[model samples]
Target: MYSQSHFVKALELLILLVVYLAYGSSYRSSSLYLYVTISIWFLVFCWLFAPFVFNPSCFEWHKTVDDWIDWWKWMGNRGGIDLAPEQSWEAWWMSEHEHLKNATIHSLLLEFILSLRFLIYQYGIVYHLHVVHGNKSFMVYALSWLVIAIARVTKGCFIGEREVCHEASNCVPHPQGHRLSCPHRFTVPSVRCF
Candidate 1:
């Protein structure tokens, strides 16, 4: 059986492919198809070869930094009180200090790659529109893509373990953090903490 992470990743790739297809012939000519296929293949290659091409130490450090953010957020909310003054200070200090220490050169390099991915996505959209349908009626789609990209970057940098928090209030310091607890509310009472 496929693990949940595998399923999720596959679903995400499927959605990207579907969107590429749905944009229709106006968006999916031979050249566009080739470009999109190559882009997807490149992402897959990076994911598969990251351990070999990149330093495993660096990847672990990045993951640790991400986990530290969640730990601080959890520590802030563990006692069911929101924004206890001391806890807020603790969370902020710990998060900032850990981020400073853990944001290694490798992490920055990976971030640069991700930024390039965003640029590719943006330009791909424009190229598809320009070549396929030639209809520029929907500048809004491009704007939406930009917004989503910004949100994704902000979320990755600040939110940590995106699975745990859907809203800024849940991951960010706020006076009413408790009010913004996971909306799903499905309890796993015996789950082990890593």
Candidate 2:
């Protein structure tokens, strides 16, 4: 039985595929082509990022983070929170939620790869329209789709960096001096290696 997340992921992919097939080849219909491509790109965005937001592991991560939050709340009620407790809580969270950490890393990797694929397809479409068909206006309109694809890829890279920073946050020396860092940095090449 497919879980809800899996079902939704499948549905999004199906919609993307349908859009790509139905309107992607009609380059003469510049408006339709541009709209379909943009919609497809946005769907890809949802495909990649929505999992991070809605995945079961995300809820688990939230729950664990909330525990530290609860601890913070307790400290606040007791008057003045110490950094040590928070650092310890951070450590505990990291140790306990290995699956969440891995899922986040893996999802980011998938997003990057899929974004690249989308961009490549856009590039090909634009190149064909410009070079083969000599359709300047259509080419320009198609460029908009290309631009969005590039932006999405840039966003994916930015998100990847931010996730790296998040995972590394524990290592920075705090007032409490909690030195913790995941040795596994989810760099782009690491995705290829996997």
TM-scores for all predictions: 0.31, 0.23
Please give the RMSD of candidate 1 to the true structure. Answer: 14.1
lDDT of 1 by residue, 1-194 (tens): 12233444555566566656666656455686778777886665555555445656545777778768965865666322234434554444444445546688998777678658556766666666455366665675667678888777775644443334433223432254332233345321221122
lDDT of 2 at 173: 25
| Per-residue lDDT of 151 in model 1 | 75
lDDT, candidate 2, at 175: 41
Q: How close to the true structure is residue 67 of candidate 1, measured as C-alpha lDDT?
A: 60
Cα lDDT tens digits, model 2, 32-88, are: 767866686676667666656765665676777986687686445421123343444
Best by TM-score: 1
Clashing pairs in 2: none
